[model samples]
Target: MSPNVNRLRVIALYKELHRLGRDYPDRSYDFNGRMRRMFEKNRHLTDPEDIEKAIQFGEYIKSETLALYSLKKYRALKRMYPSDDKH
Candidate 1:
């Protein structure tokens, strides 16, 4: 994907995460946990940075397409729930 597309994809994930975090104030832990699970489960759906190597060497490894489940997303989630200790 293009840089712009990747950026937009990240932004969309950010927005979705933001909305999820905002929607369930009391169940934030559950929400975040679910998100984390989803991340872990789909950690291998696409090869973001190694497309060429994957194709050339036939070493294709399915990686999670959702970059939002990354560390950056965790940071953002922490920022959103500053007072939450569910982590």
Candidate 2:
């Protein structure tokens, strides 16, 4: 892909992560600020390979975050409807 395409892709990923981070289980964590700093830290990455690798890592983070959200929801549901196991 062209450099412009990669740039747009990165921006989109950043925005998605920013939005997802709004409900990041830990309210004290500055997710948006941290994310901004991370992206700024990589502002010098001109190599396509490096950019691709970083993008892949960002995708991984998104997946992990979703997993955490799912787990939180599951825990809430379990609390609301406890199982009747007498073990």
Candidate 3:
């Protein structure tokens, strides 16, 4: 991908992740703050491969965040309605 395209993808991913961070599983962890710092640290890359790798890593983080949220909901449901087999 061209450098311009990579920049756009990174910006889009950053924005989406920041938005998703509002519903992050742990509010005490400063998810958005940490994400901003990490992205700032990696903002100077010029290599296409490195940028691509960073984008992929960002995608991975996004998926993991979603998984954590899903797991949280699952735990809530489990607590709300207990299974009867144990009794």
Best by TM-score: 2
Candidate 1 backbone clash number = 7
Higher TM-score: candidate 1 or 3? 3
Q: Which structure is stronger by TM-score: 2 or 3?
A: 2
Total backbone clashes of candidate 2, pairs 3 or more residues apart or in separate chains: 0
Model 3 local distance difference test score: 0.91
- Order the candidates by lDDT, highest first — what do you get? 3, 2, 1
The TM-score that candidate 2 achieves is 0.92
**Residue 31 of model 3: what lDDT?**
97
Per-residue lDDT of 16-52 in model 1, one digit per residue for the tens?
6545555444553676566556545544546667533
TM-score of 3: 0.91
Instruction: State the C-alpha lDDT per candidate.
Output: 0.49, 0.91, 0.91
Where is model 2 poorest over a 10-residue stretch in terms of lDDT?
A: 27-36
RMSD of 1: 15.3
Expressed as tens digits, the lDDT of each residue in 5-64 for candidate 3 is 998899999999999899887779999999999899999988888888889999999999
Alpha-carbon lDDT of model 2: 0.91
Q: Indicate the residue-level lDDT of 71 in model 1.
A: 52
Candidate 2 C-alpha lDDT tens digits along 5-84: 99999999999999989989887888778878888988899999999998998899889998999999999999998699
